[model samples]
Structure formats: C-alpha cells, structure tokens
Target: MQDVRVIPPYPEANEDGIREGKSKSSKFSFNFNLKPKEVKAHLDKYVIKQDDAKKTLAIAICDHYNHVAECIKREREQGDSKSDSDEEYTKQNVLLIGPTGVGKTYLIKTLAKLIGVPFVKADATKFSETGYVGGNVEDIIRDLVTEAEGNVDVAKYGMVFIDEIDKIASAANLIGKDVSGRGVQTGLL
Candidate 1:
C-alpha cells in the first residue's frame, strides 16, 4: 500500500509548526485547536477599544467553530449512521449592541475575514413583517446561500450579522404586540 498521511483537522498555529492543546500546565484550555489569545490579537490589528467585546467574541467564535469542527471529525470517523440524540449542538448567536458607527459590523466583518469564513450582513430595519411588501428576514439566509454558491450546508455554517437589531424592540407606548417587529424577530428565531 502507498504511504498515506493523515492531516489534522486544524492547522498548526503560527510559523513554529507547534500545535497547541489543553494542558494542566497552561492557564486556559485552548479548545478546538484554537488559542483565544491569538484570536484576540488578530482582532486587535483591525479594531481599537472594545477589549471586552473582542475577548468575548473571540472565545465564543473559537468555541462555536471548534464544536463544529469536532462534529465534522466525529461524523467522518464514525461514518454516516449517526442517530439524533436528546441533546444537540447549539449555536452561540451574538447580539451586538452599540450606537451607530461603533464598528459593530466592522468587528464581525474583520473576525470573519480573519477566520476565512463567508460573512453576511443585513440590516434588521430593512426586513418587513411577513405578508408585507418589503424584504424578508429569510433573505439573510438566502444571501448566505448565495455567498456559499447555493450550498445549503456551507451556508448554514457561516455567520450572518444582522445589524440594528435593537430597532425591533417593542415600543413602550404601543398597547398591543408590534406585529411587524415581532414577526421579523420570530422569523429570525
């Protein structure tokens, strides 16, 4: 048989070719083969301030994608005969709250680029309630699909940044439910 090399699911970090792992010697457990510090460092290059947000998002992204990479690895090793279990993988969706032009979109966009993943941005204000004449919330998913070249599986794994999410908050003076806002939020959920 010809010799075959099995490459690791994740590439080694930096130019040293040394792989990072969880160890009692280290202060933090770098899960999914990703070092959170490295991620934060990359964020620092493009973003200024928001250190807390950067750290939080870095950890979250590392955790989420590491889980996904582990899932893919498990499925590949175990073949396609898996069954649905009581618990399933849950995505950690982030909601960025800040004033306009605070680099909310820029932060996410930069992180996506750094991770080499497809990024989709949509304004929550642009989407109208169902049965209305404006854009649909599902359009974000559709855009992701397009970004992935019509591959549903690829699109599902990508990031969709819906800006201006706070605009959907219900008005205090309204008596009943805000159908338009509520409808869009429900659809997104």
Candidate 2:
C-alpha cells in the first residue's frame, strides 16, 4: 500500500501535516478533522470565485467525512455484526448547478485531493441506461475501484462526480423511449 501523508486537522496546517518537522503516516486510516471553512479556504487557492458553490461543497464534504469517521470509530468499538439498522446516517449528496466553465470540476477535484480520497469523474452524456452502446451506471463504481488502486474499502468512501448532468434530462417531444436521458437518470437512482 502506498503511504498516505496525513494532513493535520487544523486550517493552518500544511498539506503533509508537517508541523515542527514532524510527519505521520495514515495508511488505510481515515483521520478527517477538516472544518467547512478550512475546506473552502483550501479551494480558494485553486478555484477562482464561486464562493457559494465552494461553501456548499465544503459543508457537504465535511459532513460526509465526519460521518464516515464516526462510523469507523463506532465499528471499532462495537462488533461489525451491528447492521445498518443500529444507526441511520443520511448520505450527504449534493447537486451543483451552474453554467459551463464555473470551476465545478476543479473545486471537486481539489477537495478530493485535500481529503486524500478517491474521486471518479464521468460525463453524463457518455452513459446510457442500457448496457448497449454507451457506458453503464455501474461503470462509476468500477472507476472508483480503479481510482482506489483496486481497494474496495477505499472506494466505498470515494466520491463520484458526474458532469453535464443536465444533458440527461428527458425531453417530452421524444417518441418511443428516452434511454440515454431518462433511463440513465433512473439507473443512477
């Protein structure tokens, strides 16, 4: 396994968590202590403008990782046999809407890098509901696995960012079936 440099939980810490010339390795361990403001500040260095989008994404990302950390701690304390019924955690999913060239991709990609998590980016136009000509929805999971170096555990906590999601909107004027648009959307759900 590649050694992942863990970042300190403070906003003023460096990328590699080096403080006073000390370094720590956090391999296969989730040490998420990032606040929403810290995340937004990190994005501000790379992505220009889009303050609202950055803030929204920062909150969602922090919520998701914080929940994951809590669940991991809980599982460690209790046995793994405790099923999902024991606790309920609503997934923090966000839908970002904006015009083209608004730094959407850069924002997400940068955030994923800062958190040391796998990220899979796919264009909606290349996918279809059926597994005939276009890519399947399951491809996203497969790509995540690849991004995590074939580690399923890491992929589970990964983020899948789909671009051009609006392209999948089903048009009422279309006859017969709308496999690419409506079908893809349904398959995602």
Using TM-score as the measure, which candidate wins? 2
lDDT of 2 by residue, 1-189 (tens): 223343422223344432111122223455577788888888877888899999999998888787767676677888563456447767778888888887778788787787766788999999987756889999999999888767665667677899998889888688886778888988888
State each candidate's clash count. Answer: 0, 0
Model 2: CA > 4 A from native: 1-27, 80-88, 171-175
lDDT of 1 by residue, 1-189 (tens): 222222231233323222222222332212235567877887887789999889989988887877766665566678652336415756677778788888889988877665544579998888888778778988898898787556555455668898878888666577765655877888888
TM-score of each: 0.74, 0.78
The TM-score between candidate 2 and the true structure equals 0.78
What is the alpha-carbon lDDT of model 2 when measured against the actual structure? 0.73
* Model 1 TM-score, all chains together: 0.74
Write out the backbone clash pairs for model 1. none
**Alpha-carbon RMSD, each predicted model:** 10.2, 6.7
Candidate with best lDDT: 2
Count residue pairs with overlapping backbones in model 2: 0
